[model samples]
Target: MQQGAEYSLDDHGADGTRLVLSGHLTLASIGPFDRAVKAIDGPIHAIDLAGVEEIDTVGAWVVCRAAHRLSSEITGASPEALRLLASVQDIDVDGPMRPPRPPVWERVPLAVGDKVFGARSGIYGVVAFFGQILIGAGSLIRHPRRFPIKALVHQMELVGVTALPIIGLMSFLIGIVIAQQGSVQLEQFGAESLTVNLVGRITLRELGVLMTAIMVAGRSGSAFAAQLGTMRLTEEIDAMRTIGISPVEVLVIPRIVAATFMMVLLGFYASLMAIIGGAVVGDLTLGIPFWTFLARIQEVVPEHDLWVGLIKAPVFGLIVALAGCYHGLQVRGNSEEVGRRTTMAVVSAIFAVIVLDAFFAVFFTEIGWG
Candidate 1:
């Protein structure tokens, strides 16, 4: 068994009190001594540790804490005890254990300022990166031999062809829902036939391209971020740089080009599938023939609607690709950073697509395309 610590207070007339501590001053024996020291109410001029048989960091901490509290100096300490007490004293910070909580009024403005600064930085980074891409494009233009035709083609297959099935299925289901919902609402006015116009105009003008952009952001955008982030983590990007390769030209440019070019086709294909889906619903429930519904769509959906979707497709694709590549290039430190950047890429791309889609809607409406 360990010997418990003991202490005694020795008072001298007009000379102040001396606290004398004895026995094993260790974690297992310091408890009663700690309590006794805290209960001391008289002024202490010194603490004498000559009687301490053994000491550890925990006992040193208790001794230092009491010395600080009583404004007393420690005395008669052996070399080891003195060193331990000095080490503990050095780390004893004179402050609150936790920081004081700020007032709400102060905290709110500080948070807002941080977010604004972060957003400004992000915008600057994106613009600078875009400029780099333009420079790369110019380099390619100057030397057509450096064009990454094979890379572009491979990215096209990855970004466009592989995504067709899921995009098609999603668009088809969306079309069915739109048609079904439109029929229910139009039936109230005995104008169920107008469901054709609703499905045709909405799908071709807005839903087709918008939904496709969101899906592509979630799928291909995340993939781009993850791929680039992994390359950064593995030092492959650094190795390429060391060997005289431009990562932007070899990796980023091809992805951006592939997404931008393929979006036009994907958007168009998605619109077609949605129209087919609407036609299926029309045939199954509204007594309209499938082929007849398809034919009617061409007549009822104005040429401007198709033009609207096509115009937005490439822009949305570019935004998604840029967000992904920007976040990917930002990945650093560890594998967790890759996942974080990938999620940010997808979220930012989708948000940008939607915001731009709203802007397009307003612009197109003002230009008589509404």
Candidate 2:
């Protein structure tokens, strides 16, 4: 059976009123006890708890709150009850409800600095990863047995052959759009035939290699990061290291080699698809016919344009692979980190590719290959 609880107010001779508490002063008894306490008017001089049969933290808090409000003392509390009351006494029920936040303007400089630091750290990691991949490549050259040929073939199939459909479709569509737009502009000045020159040169010199790099970065680079990040999380990388195996040789080098070789092949394929698309668009819309379009492309789009685009493929591949593996190796703990690093890998690879392409454009132009 639960015990009953009560609080009684009695006027004292000199020291004001005494609050007499009795029975169970606990969670079960708090409702009636609290109501009885609240009914009393004026300040309480003292709290008499000797008649309290049982007490808990909740009961102690009630008594302490009443005493604090009335500015009175507590009498006849046992050691445990007294300790509970003492602990809750200093608690600031009237304290600030929420912490103050800094103004937006105050946070701008700090945010900028943090981003700068993160970019610097990422650059350093990528450079170190590139150097490590180089070392692994050299080791494979010296010790052919240590080369991961199967892994290389598998990655090539995944990163190159598997990605062909999407790369081809995207390039083809881009070519159609470029040709259509170029014809619209060129027709105004009676230069509709120049659409062939526009499509061929743009596709060969820039779009073919650049677009393929971006797509591969989004596809293969993210997969590389996710694969290695998962391995790191599961401690598989650690096991490899323990068994005297280098992760760079087994995991990193194969991916680097696959990406580097495949980019050239995929870029060439994209250029072909883009040219075909442009020819189809010209035949249908401009009535230029496929043979005429191809002949014009061959005549106008120089050999240097194709060479310039193809040469950038391997470098772009290396950037994507390095970014992906670098972030993957940086993964530390959980599935969340894996996802975060994968996204970082794709973003970093794409950014690096665009910046490098811009530099290559300036470089090729400076050498009179523009």
Q: Please name the candidate that would achieve the greatest TM-score relative to the true structure.
A: 1
Going through the candidates in order, what is the number of backbone clashes in each? Answer: 0, 0
List runs of model 1 lying over 4 Å from the truth: 1-82, 89-95
Residue-wise lDDT of candidate 1 within 253-347, one digit each (tens)?
Answer: 99999999999999999999999999999999999899999989888989999999999999999999999999999899999999999999999
Per-candidate local distance difference test: 0.93, 0.91
Report the lDDT of model 2 for residue 86. Answer: 86
Candidates in order, TM-scores: namely 0.79, 0.78
Clashes of 1: 0
